[model samples]
Target: MLKMKSTCERCRAALTLSEQAYICSYECTFCPDCTEALSQRCPNCQGDLVLRPPRTRSPTEAPSLGFKAKLEDFLYRA
Candidate 1:
């Protein structure tokens, strides 16, 4: 499963579970703004950026979207 990182690793921008995110093959995550600033490339590996899957909203889903709550409770935890 893809880790729904709570923030953009580059600029520390908040990213919600349902928000669109981009990731390289290496799973280097970034927000669309940072991705554009980097010329739509992954800084770590220069790989193509692709859409990260939106977090499932089902409450019973395994790996529940609890991370979102934690992220909100501590926006700058990372």
Candidate 2:
């Protein structure tokens, strides 16, 4: 899973999951200002930095059958 890093590696700017950010293959994360300053290249890996996809919903907010429901289903199956 892609780790949603919380700050820019270069400038230490706060990065929210829904905000614009950039990352490289190694998952070096940066905010937009730092990304532009670095010319969209990851300094650590010298890899091309691409725009990180903004997350619409947090993992906790995702729809799921509750734990009780899951356990009941499993017990029934067993």
Candidate 3:
């Protein structure tokens, strides 16, 4: 269900599930390059960044449509 959290918050790069995106506890998303530059820390929330779980795709959903929808649910739970 974790889809479309792929755009880099810092540079607006078009990131994909295959490319990997880092996200903080507050759901601040960044590309791998930006994450490395920031030392895996989210500047906005000042939290540790980690690899966002790749979104699970539905068989009937178009990939692009699904990718364009940002995720705001089920992302922050211990």
Candidate 4:
């Protein structure tokens, strides 16, 4: 399964399970807003931000949607 990371690399904003993030060649993931601000390209690889498949989570597993949560809980809160 793809690792569902919690934050955007550039802005360090939270990336939620529901939102789509652009993964670069190095697999660096960032939120759509960040991607757009970054010019729809990965600063590291200068690659495109295509829709990546959502990470598989079991029904019993609660996903940590940091961006979706209250802003205070995030490291670089969105």
Candidate 5:
């Protein structure tokens, strides 16, 4: 789950969970506005910046339960 991280890594602007942001391999985060203004290179990893998935409350509040359910759902389907 996403923590209380609410700032862009570059501009340090506030970023809500619903905001479009990019995250590097190392999870270095930046807002889309900042990323678009600059090249789509991760400042930390220098790798491609990927869109971060929205974090759900269950991931943070009930990590084990959510993880187990997701894993089981995938495993049994196969």
Candidate 6:
């Protein structure tokens, strides 16, 4: 799964799930401003930065806690 990072790596700007962002193959995330500044290239890997797909899911929906949460719940119950 895409980590869907919440901030721009360069400027530390907040990036919402539905907002326009950019990423490279290595998932180096950036805001539109920074992306333009860098000429759509990933500073870390020197790869092309492309538009990240916006998440279509509603923001109000709760995020899953994944495997660690399940394991913790089971341990607590036991």
Candidate No. with top TM-score: 2
> For candidate 5, lDDT tens digit of each residue in 1-78?
344367898899987776778887777888898788658888777888778877544344654567788898899999
Q: What is the C-alpha RMSD of each candidate to the true structure, in Å?
A: 10.2, 3.7, 11.5, 12.3, 7.5, 4.0
Candidate 2, residues 1-78, lDDT tens digits: the string is 789999999989999999999999999999999999999999999999999998987876876578967997899999
C-alpha lDDT of candidate 2 relative to the true structure: 0.92
**Candidate 2 residue spans exceeding 4 A from truth:** 65-78
The stretch of ten residues in a row with the least summed lDDT in candidate 3 is 69-78
Give candidate 1 misplaced runs (Cα > 4 Å).
Answer: 58-78
State in Å the error of residue 60, model 1. Answer: 7.6
- What order do you get sorting by lDDT, best first? 2, 6, 1, 3, 5, 4
Better of 1 and 2 by TM-score: 2
Quantify how close model 6 is to the true structure by its C-alpha RMSD in Å: 4.0
Clashing pairs in 5: none
The digit string of per-residue lDDT tens for model 6 on 1-78 reads: 786889999999999898999999999999999999999989999999999999977544656488977997999999
The C-alpha lDDT values of all candidates are 0.83, 0.92, 0.77, 0.73, 0.76, 0.92
- Work out the TM-score per prediction: 0.68, 0.78, 0.64, 0.59, 0.64, 0.73
Q: Order of all candidates by TM-score, from best down to worst?
A: 2, 6, 1, 3, 5, 4
| Model 6 stretches astray by more than 4 angstroms | 58-78
In model 2, which range of ten residues has the least summed lDDT? 56-65
lDDT of 3 by residue, 7-53 (tens): 89899999776668898877888998999999998999889999887
How badly does each model clash, as a count of residue pairs? 0, 0, 0, 0, 0, 0
Between candidates 2 and 4, the one scoring higher on lDDT is 2
Model with the higher lDDT, candidate 3 or 4: 3
